[model samples]
Target: MAEKPRLYYFNGRGRMESIRWLLAAAGVEFEEVFLETREQYLKLLEDGFLLFEQVPLVEIDGMKLTQTRAILSYLAAKYKLYGKDLKETALIDMYTDGTMDLIFLIAMLYFKPPEQREKETELVVEKAKSRYFSVFEKILKNHGQDFLVGNKFSWADIQLLEVILMVEELSATALSKFPLLQAFKARISNIPTIKKFLQPGSQRKPQPDDHYVATVKKVLLM
Candidate 1:
């Protein structure tokens, strides 16, 4: 039997959720190592365990992997979550890259001061919906498929689902206008393994409340 992979990240989902979803979908048993404190993260860095000096590190087959997309790509290929062929993989890569671009915009909002967050978030949300969301919806429509690549679920779909969930959590609104994207998220969530991972008692941590949006509010009161 192959040795199970072990994932390292903070308690929150952050960049690790897509990889987690992939693992669950693959039905592979893996261990999650949560570094809940600065000390733990620093110690790992000191030990040179993280090649990229980041979390969401995966140890498998005596090899360590880092980077969110890189890890997801490797796992997707390993477990056949990567699409059916080279052409499909290229499309998957394109969609995944686009999703990451949106994710970066949201992350930037978190780092802004409280006074600027609302205005910034609103602008970013509008741009994301108009640009990124529209593109994804069009892709689904063009392909006449529920998934971004081919007709089956792939890592691209998982990444898209994670991006949607993150945006909804940050904005507290659904993508009502983009019905196809909304439906895509719903379909991915309903996958048996993904559903199981989402159920109560799952090890996944609740999204952090002290995130940049909330922190800025607190800072302003002081």
Candidate 2:
């Protein structure tokens, strides 16, 4: 058995992707147990041999940890990828949660029926985009760095990228109003580690059950 960090996360590659990016970026080896089917989840649960609790559980040999976001934060901290200044860490958290909100709103809007989506977007879309983009716009305005916090690449950068991709996957014109945000994503996206992680060969490709993936597929068909 290899002594690599083991991560039990969604096979569809949801929130767990950024964690994979961090590990891949660090050249850290680990087991990836993917769960994208109910049968798979049930079978894993039925097999009592599986340790720890949740799907996104990460086992560091004898030590097992859980939670998707927290796992990435721990890895970022352990690898000195969290950025230099304490203030940078603070901003990272702020931007990360902000980006998460946008992704969440997209899901909520999508789950709603046509009439409901109309009723909801009046308050959701603008607020979601503004709240998320405001923090990012501020970061780009203050830091010429390729990433969200300070001058180094961090988890927040990946989180923001996911949000932009998710939005674009929902609305192609998602970032048209904010060229800086678009440019920022384009810049951060080409980082060697992130670029490799997002390559065609990587299993990070979106899946069916994925909300954004399904939406994009629907758009393409129309």
Candidate 3:
């Protein structure tokens, strides 16, 4: 049997969460090595595991992969979740890239001072609804398909689904105006692999809280 891919990162979501979601959507099992202290992170850098001196690394198929996009692309294409054609792949890329914008925006909230967080969250939520979610809502409405690209499940769908839930965590009514997206969420969540990951006791991590933020700050020396 092939060994499961092993992930290296702080215990929190960060960029690795998408990788975990994609792997789960692909029905692949994996392992994680969480960095609990600054020493562990520095040790990996000293060992040359982090090519860019940053994390979200993975060991898969005998290669140590760095960069979140590179790792996700490799897993997506390998698992046949990338799409059926170059055009479809391009569409997937466009959608995935857009989601990354929102992902990073929300991620920065964890580092914000408590006073700034509420206001920043409002901005993030507004940007998500106006800039990001609206675009996806239009796509789903026009395409009238179950999946994001080519009417088939792809990495883009997985990414959008993940981001949709992330935004919902911030605003419960995030999808209220986007009926198609609400349906899209329900549909995607029903997929067997994704459904399993959504259940408790799976590899999926929870939203970052005070402890997670502090631990990550210490680990990365931020």
Candidate 4:
């Protein structure tokens, strides 16, 4: 028997979601350690459990990994969710990086002060939807395939779906114009394991304004 991999993040999905979806999709059983409080996260930070003082940490194969993309890529390769060849892998990386960039912008909106959030939200949404979302739509159109790379489901598509959901959460109108991207979301969500994960009462939680993000902001103020 193999050791069950352990994932450390806040109780909410956040950056760890792509990993969670990949783990579920790959049928890999893993342990989730939720840091529900600032004290818990600070303790881990003091104890040197986090490499970059961030969450979404993973312990697998006796290695402690940080960074969302790095963790997702490692799991994808380990569980055969990665591309079939070097070229495909490179394209996957490109798409994954693009998703991460969008994720970062959304995170900025979430962390922005309430007073500035309205204006920030408008600017971020306009820029992101036009630039990032349009680029993604073009990619899907160009590939003319169900998946981002090699016409097969890969970590890239999974991450892309996650980002698309994030955009929708932030703006609430992201998918209205991007029919292909909307279809992509449906395709990924229909995967058996992912569908199971999406069921009501599943471990996944709703996005933004969650307790975890609130606690972190309060702690930062203290």
Candidate 1, superposed: residue stretches over 4 Å from native: 211-222
Please write out the lDDT profile of model 1 over residues 13-130, one tens digit for every residue: 5677667777887778788886655677778788888887766789987888989888888999989888787898898888888888887777666556779988988888788788
Instruction: Order candidates by TM-score, high to low.
Output: 3, 4, 1, 2
**Between candidates 2 and 4, which one is better according to TM-score?**
4
Models ranked on lDDT: 3, 4, 1, 2
**Any residue pairs clashing in model 1, and if so which?**
none
Task: Give one digit per residue, the lDDT tens place, for model 3 in 39-142.
Answer: 99989999999999999889999999999999999999999998788899899999999999899999889889999999999999999999998999999889
Candidate with top TM-score is: 3
**Candidate 1 all-Cα RMSD:** 4.2
**Per-residue lDDT of 101 in model 3:** 83
Instruction: Please list the residue runs of candidate 2 whose C-alpha ends up more than 4 Å from where it truly belongs after superposition.
Output: 36-53, 107-125, 207-222
Off by over 4 Å in 3: none
Candidate 4 Cα misplacement greater than 4 A, ranges:
37-39, 218-222
Candidate 4 residue lDDT tens string, 21-94: 78877878889887766788788889898888877789999899998878888899998888899999998898
Number of the candidate with higher TM-score, 1 or 3: 3
Q: Higher TM-score: candidate 3 or 4?
A: 3
lDDT of each: 0.77, 0.67, 0.93, 0.81
Q: In candidate 2, which residue pairs get closer than 3 Å at backbone N, Cα or C atoms, i.e. clash?
A: 8-55, 11-35
- Cα misplacement distance, residue 161 of candidate 1 (Å): 1.3
Backbone clash total, candidate 4:
0
